[model samples]
Target: MLRLFLRKYRTMILASVFFFYLGCCLTINFTRIECAFKTSSKNELETRVQSLSKAQYVVIILSSPNNEPKRDAIRATWGNFVNNIFVENGEIINKWNHTRISKQSQQNVVKLLFVVGTLGLSGTKADKLGNEQKRYKDFLILENVEDSYKNLSLKLLNALSWISENLKDMKYVIKCDDDSFVRIDLIVKDLDAFAPSMNAPKLNKFVTFKEHLPTYKGLYWGYFNGHAEVFLTGKWQEKGWFLCDNYLPYALGGGYVISRRIVDYIAQNMDFLSSYNAEDVSMGVWTASLNAINRVHDVRFDTEWKSRGCKDNMLIRHKQTTSDMFQMYKSLAQSNGEKLCNTEELHRKTYFYSWNVLPSSCCKRN
Candidate 1:
């Protein structure tokens, strides 16, 4: 009788055992796959951070989405070079050193990349931009903002956010337009000499004010304007929330340098910052509220509504044509960094920024 009962239930018991074993195997495989995916994601982020750490200074060039030629000119000119420092096996090496494949390394690269905005209308230029980015791997596209003259403030916002996300470890960040000409070597020389002094804001020991209370901290270096009147009606008017008779003091957008702390501070408060008509003005307004800020106004940066002429010592010059860029690069490269423009070409008369005069006439021509 026992043997007959076992035979009757044999098929059901075998089926139950097989199903249990199959379920256990599937569960184990799924968990392993999920863990692999997570590990891969984490590793990708770590790799990005490690690679980006090689740059001491990064220049974020604001470019137009459709202006591929402008970007190309920049690439062929001053923005073409790469000099990154890496530490491998307790030794310092450069990116060009192809001798040793470093298993473990620390990267510090000083490089430049273009930050462009999206084209809201069609996909033609957008597709081209995507392909260009893939080729160079140096583009930071702001998907939310449209690339237009009026929307530059938003473009700047997204650019700084990108820096905060990827290149936050860099010592300094320089923001400039695509048309600007940058003499990076000269700028680097000044930085090496005056970095500590640059970091410290000019404060008086006798007077205690909120602006000067902070010590050597946020350094904002560029050509600054404190008396730009608010225009109510014009092509470059301010209808935004910047309710002021004069715009807050800010470095001109052509080419300005900011310390890492400044970038971090801006990133931390990105969500609440107001949008202004001009990106430079927006920067000034947003930074006006910070407790610690060191504003360094230097005339060497020829960044303004117009160029202050071609001075030999100028570090940056805005409103350069594509042709002008090629010419400038050729002059500098051929003369071994002595001459600026061709001898035949006319150099504009240089002017000074009268900061000591009346507040209303701060940047007036002498």
Candidate 2:
């Protein structure tokens, strides 16, 4: 009878005993659930991400004022998944009330926001964008930064700054292009699998990596370009990139992932960071100098200069036209998400980055 009673409350008894030992051994004790959450596995950072600390990930789309059609296409399609927003007849009826994201919603809550620049936006265009922001409440407009290809890096820095100042609770930030089609479900699943390994220490880029290498604490996942040549004078000319013979190896700008610490670092030090011509290149330079960083060169990210065609488990595909987005979304919906894309429709050769090779020879014909 005693054994049966003990067995019935085994977990609670064990927990109480374990915490009692902790209280004796440590200076602080679990007086309340808050302290327990701090010292126990109940409030592990990964646990928070898996359940609800705040939003685990926020997809920040770099957009232009003129890309309303592309934005609408995304909102109505892949970006409109159950995990994302819900818009009705071009207006955000916000089916999910804009309250503090509840613990239930945080399990897979991947929010979406567009980053636009207000350099030349005026009168009708500005008014239209204002109306759109009012309707959707999903835009981060960098008023000082110009919405141009040349200012993309600046745009990115400002966006990170905004995230740090405002939505700082998110664990991961996905910097995606407006044209890219994001696979949110696949990404969330992959991220959960990737979360247990996140145990790195404070991430600061200004602290030069000279002494012992800091054990990697965070993640930077994307398709990285190991070698990219510079243009001294051209449409892509960068007057500020004199750091090395080639630009620092950077993940392609179409879509990439960085942890919150990285975002915080950039946001905190953005005023002093240099803005190169390419936002991705700036990202490389910024993170390359960080205390410690672990990068996953995910081939699943077809975010190179162009798509590596359509693969089975792609996380995000860049250079997608508005039409392409609709078609792909339609196929996924019809197949109940079992079929990602029509293999017959997008027939391009697949390739991988040769990380084993030298930086200059990383990309090869395969």
lDDT of 1 by residue, 225-325 (tens): 77888778887877875456788767899998888888888887888888787889888888876655666677678888777567656678899999989
**How many residue pairs clash per model?**
6, 1
lDDT of 2 at 194: 40
Q: Mind giving the per-residue lDDT tens digits that candidate 2 earns over 1-366?
A: 999999999999999999888877665443565576557633443453333234566888999999999999999887865453323343222232223434343333567879999977778999899789768767777878879998898899988887776664687888899899998766665565444242224222111121233456667877777778887898889887778888877888889889888999999898888888889988999998766576656667788777768865677899999998999888887876767787744456544556566779876645
Root-mean-square deviation per candidate: 9.4, 21.1
Best by lDDT: 2
Query: Per-candidate TM vs. native?
Result: 0.73, 0.73
Model 2 pairs in collision: 200-217
TM-score of predicted structure 1: 0.73
